[model samples]
Target: MVGRFTRGLRVVDDSVDVFRDNPRLAILPLLSLLSIGGAFAIVLGTALRYGAVSSVLTSDLLQYAAIFVAIAVSSSVGTFFNAAVVHCAFQYFDGKETSVRGGLAAAWQVRRKIALWSVTAATLGTVLYIIDENFGALGSLARVLFDLAWGLLTFFVIPVLVLEDTKGLRPLLQESGTAFRETWGESITASLGISFVFFPVGVIGLSVLGWAYLFASGVPALLIGSAGFIVLVAAMVAAQVLGMVARTALYRYAVADEKVGPCAGRNPETIFPSD
Candidate 1:
């Protein structure tokens, strides 16, 4: 019942500290982004060139199936790097030496688990999206609520999967759900606070960059858009990294019964203070 926003912010600060301690941990996420984006572009280009779009637009089955595959791939890649980040963060928390390559190697060792979990998660996610797309207003609202709950419940799944390779999706999901049930306040605030702080900045920066399209010709407009996109992506990457690191710190505290880092040293109530 310790739902303190201030405590959550402190957890966030601890995560930033971890990132500062080992900035290379963030590189895996960047690579993950590039890989996912490349896969998406390849699929889209192939689909368009081969007239898959003709069927996709007309057939619900095709559309939903395509959505499932794309999301599954993207989730798998994203989860891979996120798990990698968690592993690296653990090293940071332990005061052990680690690198992005080492983290990637650890994550690679459990690639199959990551893929399985990603598929399971992606299936649920795709179903939610389909419901939202087809069910009109009610589906949209349901999707919003469902997505939030799903995110909360599975927030620790990647870290769990990385740390405990023997555990299957069911056990990992259960552990993730249980961890959040116990530390819901700190977990929710860590992510929510970051989003609340960065979303506006991203919006404002994009708006300024978007304005370039109005006044600049051709290449300048492209440059402005690309610059804006990079900034936005960088913000998102930072947010995800911080959240994952905080979650790592929490996981160690909650499950491992070890409160070694700054993140765990702080009280839960202070993270998001009632005041």
Candidate 2:
């Protein structure tokens, strides 16, 4: 197995290839729409069932806990689905036949690793939250640093776990390290590029919607709000799709450059014959 530090370095450089390839762009919007809709429905249902929103606003601790749990579960499922979609995109990018069925099957094959990574991420996030809430000024600074480091370091964990069928912390760490070292700069650049394109459009659209909402009332509000919501949702879906595509491109690049292990199944040459 490759060392974590080396893998991290490779990931950084591979990010450039990921963005350039744009492997999963075509399917991202559909996947994003499904994920968002599913997540919304789950969260909304939980809120209605337990009056979570009202209770949380009223500062009820128990209600807040329940709401948090609901949100976490829903978000987890959404993430799993998204991971599956990205995995499928990788398969397709590698010139394999990829359908939703194949993606789900692949996801199931590595569900344990995905779940472990998710749990680990959630725990780390909770720890940071707790430190931020209870600690002094220095503690807060430490939390920020922790998050920043993890954010950069763990960028490739999903791709590694899902695409490579990697298990345990060791593989995850190794792949993440390789990805970071090889492609961090490129990944950051691609993210910035995507943000630059999407953020301005979102801001302008939202600002216009806000003004229209303030000026309108009754049926007009309904009409304009509905239209704005649709547009915003569409934009969000597009952005997510673009992000997945970019990430996929970066992952393939990292794999190629680092000559990391073969993907989940099949012989190495089947995917990259020259290797």
Where does candidate 1 stray beyond 4 Å? 1-5, 218-223, 262-264, 269-275
Residue 143 CA displacement from its true place in model 1, Å: 2.7
Off by over 4 Å in 2: 1-71, 258-275
TM-score against truth, every candidate: 0.89, 0.71
Per-residue accuracy of model 1 over 1-275 as CA lDDT, tens digit each: 33444555666677778788888876888898899999989988999899888899999888888888988998889888988898888887777898988888988999988888878877988899888988999999999998888888887887788887556777888988887776676667777766766677688667757787677779888888778777777777888788788788777766765764545655654544423
lDDT scores in order: 0.79, 0.61
Model 1 error, position 212 (Å):
2.3
Can you give the lDDT of residue 50 in candidate 1? Answer: 96
Candidate 1 vs. truth: CA RMSD?
2.7
lDDT of 1 at 230: 77
lDDT per residue as tens, model 2, 1-275: 12333333333334334433544443544664676567778877987898767766676455445445544554466556667667766765666666666666766787777677766666666666667767889879999899788878877776777777565888788887787677665566555555655666677667657866899888887777777766666556555655555566667766674232122332223332221
Best by lDDT: 1
